[model samples]
Target: MKETAQKYKRQTASRYLPVGAQEITSKIMEAESYGVSTKHDGHFYLLSYDGKKATLTNHGGRVIDDLPLLKEATALLKGKCKTVVLAGELYLHKEGGRTRSFDMTAALDDKSTNIYFAAFDLLSLDGEQVSLDIKALDQKLNTVLSSGKSLHAVKNSFVESRKDIAALYKEIVEDDGQEGIVVRSHNGPTYKIKPLITLDAVILGYAEGQGSRAGMLKEVLVGLCVAKDEYILLTKVGNGYSEEERKNLLKELGKKKVDSGYIEVSGSNVAFTMVAPNQVVEFSCLDVFGENSKGVISKMCLSYKDGTYTANGKQPMASVISPVYVKMRTDKKPDTNDAGLSQITKIISLDINASEKLDVKKSEIVSREVYVKISKGAKMVRKFMVWKTNKEATGEYPAYVYHYTDFSAGRSEMLKKEIKVSDSKKQIEEIFAAEVLENVKKGWEKVKS
Candidate 1:
């Protein structure tokens, strides 16, 4: 009787969380598939739906102020399935509002943009919510997805062929929507946030703004791409292009404003009145939210900011891009370097937690040996291999890596418990040489835990 009473109280408390931050609890989630999801309440944290009443402060409002997720949320919820503890974005998707989606619905205050819950992972399901068993959670999630509810949950995928999907990506981009693709692992219930390496997008036109906006022409077109053809519209931007670039674009685009005003571009169902697709801008962006039929791309940037405007390089203010300006890029076709590893890395950074997405088997100091052009007049030391990719030799992948400058004394302790430090007697003697040498080697540390 005491255990039963305590259970009831605990369940009731699960309805509310402290305001500012939230943490994953020990709740065991059974097997269940997660659709890309969005949290409806702006709150970064939430109370589990206990089928009682709204316990969260905003019961119906958001505390986290998250934009819509770029991917759709889905899951099959019936049958003799295991209890699933799902983790994902919880959002409100107004019912019966196909065209409006999250952005339009929220902004327009359309009641139709009802709340929605899209889980991306199965933390636990069917009487098992493992606190640390990610693999178990993943498997359970897949089991639930097999129930067949995903076909209608949100964005649907029916594989045809890789060639077909690639072609479709170009059509969506031509439509002036988001730019990229989502390749699901047929081997498992996993979806990767991928960037286009050779995709196409329609040309909408350049933005009309100032200062950094001065001169040579650039663009700001409403764009889209594919799944088989994933096309999503990007967001509001007043920065990016320079004034000179804008001017060049105006002069060139003026000639394209046709009698019909409907300028045909690349990618999906996208069209621009004044801007034409004569010139393709190479770049990258972040994938945000998506509707059943549309997708979203945010934080887009030109790979090359120095290149001349293809539109009107000869017109007034047709300033040539400075070489130092690091020709954002211009060597290959716009589609050649579509979204690739670089793109996927960026997207993964945003959607998945560091611990969840990255391989955490062993953490350690990462080192790489590359020759920097030092002053020829200065003494140089023999170079040695510090870090190397096993990919080239062992056919294995490399880890996501970064470096930091350390000038501070041992203000912070070096690598701690769970990881050890080693040095040969001769190596330690060598490291004891000059203070400058010790300083450099001392700073070169790693994280192993």
Candidate 2:
């Protein structure tokens, strides 16, 4: 295990600048098995399925002029991961009269020019050569690159015609982080390179269809973000999300009241409108058609960024009560859609989940308050209570018991008759208290009998 990248190493001192056209460096590099795909319909690294060795084509490559950085960039590979070649731009930094890669005026002395590795296909693995067709290799990228980093899949197909690609390209350049969108054909092989893209878009409104959208609105509202404003109804998305997801989403939107009229399907506008523009959902779509959304929408899918986790975390309190809006939507004379109990659950689920999460074991409670009273020298202070079988006439109805107890001799006295009531708790306690006061009893013993 000697500390050297290649079993063999050699570099010529002849200097060449990278600012030359795409082909000269590519031709020279390809001659040395460095530059990639000969065809430049679109730029990509032609790689075997395994990453043991790769060829970099000069589609958008401009950093390859320096020969030393190219050799140094080649050295940046990790030998243990996959035994395949990689192709990418070898960027350098220029400092103190020397041109280098990927540096500010500083770090020129250290001499670090690393390769920005952009892999396309799996060339070989476990000594198994990548003899698979481009279609199978694309499927492999989805499997391997689904989680960790593998190869970047090149765009080769289109759902939209050429018009869509130009519009999307403009949007991609505008978005600060987006590399740009790619429109590819479903049947086109991965190596078919040319892809058409439509304009990038931002969501403005979502449609939940009437009668069924405790299911879904059947369509969603989409638009483009211009310099400051979001354009109207470029398209509507209904392709993504599951049945449960659609239901959950409608439940969320119904809770929120939109202040403005949402861009909607022209003839199919239901009672729904603007909602809180708090969520930014992203979709990779292939086409942009129609002035406003038709009743129908396109077929590409999208994944919501927030997912269920958005509802699970510390959710923002509603800016206003939604029942008024709910009533407005439901009670409108023209709108026959009456939302049912199952349709609205915001105020209920939160309380239920909170109770469950905070559940505590409950047991019988003992009274802890201390009571103090003067002992009567006469004998007792009787108490009496009268109750009615009638549940409606319940207000202080026990006051009639005073008519039965005697206090005529200027002292608390006896019961007019024996008080009894099918072992009623309040009535029994009253009878015992009255008996005690007529004689003498205190504390628990006073109430026990």
Candidate 3:
């Protein structure tokens, strides 16, 4: 079951609109027919009925057996001759009003009753694998799964030209308030068509690379300037950089390194090297959400001056989805107008949490430790500190932070640091212990705090 779930995760599609809608339309005109469907903002899960029971598993291989809708699915699929597997989205479907992706996220977190499953693909039927075309898959799904109160087929249609696609986009995305639409080519690649939201942001830092990209740029951290020297943490862009661009951009950004008082890490677990906010870059995203999938507010404000970046407070900001690096804007300065926060706010209405506030208090240091190691008359120093941000009530900053700083005068990049934030004391203790075990070597002597 795990292998099956891994083999066919959600089908990711390439974007077509905002950049090359016409070029994509020209390419699609060559194909015979394409299947287009409204893209629902929801979580992807695989539903399976193996004769005796129906199991619903997410992309992470964790089975969600407690969903009340599972009982209805089991009742409908038990009569099938073989084990049936279907791929669909679990979304919030209100009977009378419009529901967005964030609503679905909140619903899932609170176990809301409005959640519904919209089946899109038919992976298996009668215990046999199905490799049908787009139209055939739609037909098979309609024939296999009946529309119930908790389950229904996703809205889809067939298109052979650009006009059809544009009409669907106008009706579904622009008029109907959907996030976007997905079109599957008859026998070729699939494309996701959505109006791209563009923003000019300042480059804040870059996370170190890994694997094949070692010593190169893995991700670029960006921010929106809300005022003359104030910025908000926007997102960590990891895509749209060519292999050559990665090496070249990294070298260019290396000269602007600064000792920013805050730390941010990438999904790959590499620490970011802070840089001066002097460069303006363009980025495009499909959409932005104020809350993450886990129902946590995702907003952080910062103050920058004199080659230093400090956290100001947690304010209202949107977390971008699939942020793609466009280019470096050499003509524009990294100021409020060029990299303004209103660029995003004017386009989409951010769902601001009532509890979110800009109430940042002074961070209190709970513990401090310093260690010294001298070799060949060169002194190397390590400092570890544990502090409470006191802004945890805002749901933006972590309750506790474990910071490790290393300064070696012998190295080219003389100073390196790592920061770990958590809400649990046990986890912080484990992190502090791990750092001590690894860095406190034979020559290192502890200094009184």
Best by TM-score: 3
Model 1, span 77-141: residue lDDT tens: 43434343344333444443221222423432443233444333433345554443333434554
| Candidates sorted by TM-score, best first | 3, 1, 2
**Per-residue lDDT for 3-120 in model 3, tens only?**
5655565233112322233334564545788888887766667788888777788655678766778788788777744688888778888765554555654576676667888888
- Give the worst 10-residue stretch by lDDT in candidate 1: 312-321
Candidate 2: RMSD to truth: 27.8
The candidate that achieves the highest lDDT relative to the unseen native structure: 3
TM-score of model 2 vs. true structure = 0.22
Tens-digit lDDT track for model 2 on 291-372?
1111111121112222210111111111111000101122221111221111112211111122111111222211111122
Q: How close is candidate 3 to the true structure, as a TM-score?
A: 0.55
Candidate closer to the true structure by TM-score (higher is better), 2 or 3: 3
Clashes of each: 105, 44, 0
Report the alpha-carbon TM-score of model 1 versus the true structure: 0.27
How accurate locally, in lDDT, is each candidate?
Answer: 0.29, 0.31, 0.75
